[model samples]
Target: MTPHNELRLLPWSGPDGKPCFLSTDNTNGHLSRLADNTEAIQLDLATELLDYASVLLNGAETDSEELRALATDLTEALRDTLRVAESRGHRLPPPHTDTHADDTDSPTLPAAAFG
Candidate 1:
């Protein structure tokens, strides 16, 4: 059995907007394939929406109703994209950490660097 941390985050939600997860060792299984395809479709749709939004926004005669609809669609697409990112992030291998480094040996960056 896969560990809890290793469980796959499914692309779709469950009842009441709860997240859904899949626990399996087979990457090529039916559910995995389905989720993969769904993610691909979602990404494609988001790309197409970006193009449409650019065109719509560039038009001088754009209407309020059309802008509102575009905003709604963009919101949904952003949500899906975030979910996909979270799912894939969890699946990535944990970053390597060094425990033996001396505190004094660490380099410090200026506060302005962060900005």
Candidate 2:
């Protein structure tokens, strides 16, 4: 039997927005179930966000508040999805590099590079 100190993925953030890991060895324990439920809710929220976006787009007019709320929901859902991916052992790719650019030279449009 495994000990209770085994680390398990957290379902949500703590009071200060940090991930909270639970130390438990049971595969079917309460914390494990909670994590699974959280992951499912996150994925479902993402799907709901897409549906809401489509509805908003189809409407004749949209208020700024509605748009802002949608954006917030989208961001939270994305973060949750990323957490799920991390728990599954997936990682983000390295930042893209410009092979033509030199190491010592600064980017051409430093102030407006992103655009």
Candidate 1 lDDT over 1-115, as tens digits, reads: 3333668888899988999999888888999999999999999999999999999998889888999999999999999999999998888776655554564645666899999
For all predicted structures, in order, the TM-scores are 0.79, 0.65
Score candidate 1 by TM-score against the native: 0.79
lDDT, candidate 2, 1-115, per-residue tens: 4432356557588899887887655768887888888889889989988898999979989999999998998898888888887765422334456654466434356666676
lDDT, candidate 1, at 99? 50
- Quick one: best lDDT, which candidate? 1
